[model samples]
Target: MRAMAYESYGGSDVLKEMRLPLPKVAPGEVLVKVECAGVNPVDWKIMAGGLDALMDVVHPVVPGWDVAGTVVRLGIDVPEFAEGDEVMAYARKDYVHGGTFAEYVSVPVRALARKPASLGWEQAAGLPLAGLTAYQLLTRLDTGPTDTVLVHGAAGGVGSLGVQIARSLGARVIGTASPHNHERLRGMGCEPVEYGDGLTERVRALAPDGVSVVADFVGGVLDVTLAVLRDGGRHASIADHSVLGSGGQWMWVRPSAADLTELARLADTGALTVPVLRTFPLHELPEAFELSRSGGAAGKIVVRP
Candidate 1:
């Protein structure tokens, strides 16, 4: 099988296209023929050895966590799916060897779920990791009819979905982004605030009473969000929250099949949308990684094998 791997941790230049033996299905796992793979910030973060304390890696690491594909073979213990079943999942916990940046990837049966029939492979590929992060963060908050929640990075992969999820839960949504994404954020039912100097003041002018819940996708604004939250309110972040002075929970999202299924249903019903900034072939993974790290993408970058 053809795969993209990086032998050392560094920048995108370390990634290379190479041939490797096809992975065999393990007990309780299924081998998938990947159709599309999603690129995320964690992929590059692990490439830079940012999370070395939390996980270990080996040579020729595959970086993809989000995948959309078809099941080609099932392990002996897996009875829920058979060959030819189309699915999307978060695969591989080990950044070194667990990955979907190849023609085929082996994943536990529980991590895989049926893809939404209405979505294409590219859209389905973009949902697993980012969508789950947004869902889990919102679930940790005290969202109610009178509560207002602020979402930073409102136009990016996770924040875009966070805005919609908060609104669907009956909370007043406040989202932050640059001028270019203001209209889109408004369409998602959020009051858009520009993310810069006086961000708290801008949010105050709109909400006046302050937000009850804040979900920060951009770690740089933790202080600003803390200032904008009302006393006793909660703040959650997918980024580092050690510097955040709030008492609310600092969150890290792990893959969950139940969460993915709910997100899939939301996308199928037009309540969610996974925007794709670009698509690339498997061999061009380095380029895809570079684009994801460039900080200007309007949506997730997807790769197809």
Candidate 2:
């Protein structure tokens, strides 16, 4: 199989396309022929040797976590899926050979879920990591029809899905984005706020009592997020680790097949949208990585295998 792997952690340049042996499945796992892989901040972060202390190193590491593929074979005792099932997943974080940036990956059955029928491989590929993170954040808020939720970075991957999820739960959503995305945010049922000077005041003007809940995707904006929240309202941040000093929780998204099922439903129903800003073929993975780091890409960057 052809894969992009790095013998040592360095930068995107270390990611090279080569022919490597296909992964072997263990009990409770399945082998998937990957169609598309979704790239995230973690992909580049790990590539840059940023996670050296936290991760155990093995040479020739493949760095993607999000995969959309079809099952080609199942491991011993795995019964939930059979060969030829189309599935999508956020593969477990530490599987060295299960990285999605290849023609095939072997992942645990626990991490897999059927891909939504309405979406193609690229859109299905985009769902797992970002979608699950957005779902968990909104779920933590316990939002309801009576609540008004504020989401930061409304135009980005997780934030874009979150804006719609919050609205789908019957809550009014107020989202922060650049001026250019305000109309886009509005289309997703968000009251758009520009994330700059007077951001707190702007949100306050909209929800005078204060926002019922605040979920920040862009870190370093804690002061502004807390200021706009109603007294004792819930606040969550997924970005930086800076303490907000408000008894709020710092969130890290975990992999969950159950959560992906719900997100898939939303996409199938036309209540959610996954935008692919661009797609790169397997050989051009480095170019995709460069664009991903440069910022201001319109939507999720996908890699086709």
Candidate 2 overall Cα lDDT vs. reference? 0.87
What tens-digit string does per-residue lDDT give for candidate 1 at 1-305? 89998888899988888888888788988999999999998899898998889887877787788999999998998888989999999775644675989999998877788898878999999999988888899987766677899998888899998988888778999899999999988888889988888998999998788888988888878778878899888888888666445576678887777888888888888888888989998988988988888886888899999
Error of 2 at 69 (Å): 0.9
Model 2, which residues run further than 4 Å from truth? Answer: 95-97
| Model 1 segments more than 4 A misplaced | 243-245
Number of the top lDDT candidate:
2
Q: Estimate, for each residue in 1-305, the C-alpha lDDT of model 2 and write its tens digit.
A: 99998987787879888888899988989999999999888888888887788777677888798999999999999888999999999996553534899999998877889999988999899889988888898898797798999998989988998998998889999999999999988889899999999999999999999988888888888888778888878888898667457777788888887888888888889898888889999988888888889876668999999
The model with the greatest TM-score is 2
Query: Candidate 2 at 266: error in angstroms?
Result: 1.3
